[model samples]
Target: MKRNVRLVVARLRQRLTAAGNPGLFQALRDGAAEGRSTGRHRRVD
Candidate 1:
């Protein structure tokens, strides 16, 4: 079940990416990178 879910998600992501939704993909990738950077984002003023 878990593997199937992962496959489905991966396929969906690929289709969206192929569709040239760069802004949306970038938003998601940015959020993931931020989480990896510090578990969260730093404050900005």
Candidate 2:
């Protein structure tokens, strides 16, 4: 199950890179961090 999840995530990342949005994930992570600082309890993963 964990392997499958990793494969899916890898594929999605490849697709995102192909589409020229490689920094998309990083931006989202940064946004999540900012939200956390504001006391948001949302889980990105």
Candidate 3:
């Protein structure tokens, strides 16, 4: 259905953002580069 396809597209967008954006998936690396700053971990659940 159309709604199902929309949901799939939204999920794909989230996956792409998480994978492509360093500020998102690379939080630990980013924090470390900022002189050991602490950041909240990304939530997957």
Pick the TM-score winner.
Answer: 2
C-alpha local distance difference test of each model: 0.69, 0.73, 0.55
Best by lDDT: 2
- Candidate 1 — which residues are off by over 4 angstroms? 1-12, 41-45
lDDT of 1 by residue, 1-45 (tens): 768967875776798789988677667657757767888743222
- Give the worst 10-residue stretch by lDDT in candidate 1: 36-45
Ten contiguous residues with the weakest lDDT in model 2: 25-34
Worst 10 residues of 3 by lDDT: 36-45
| TM-score: model 1 vs. ground truth | 0.47
Residue 2's lDDT within candidate 2 is 71
Q: Which pairs in model 3 have colliding backbones?
A: none
Candidate number with the higher TM-score (2 or 3): 2
| Ranked by TM-score, top first | 2, 1, 3
TM-score of each: 0.47, 0.54, 0.42
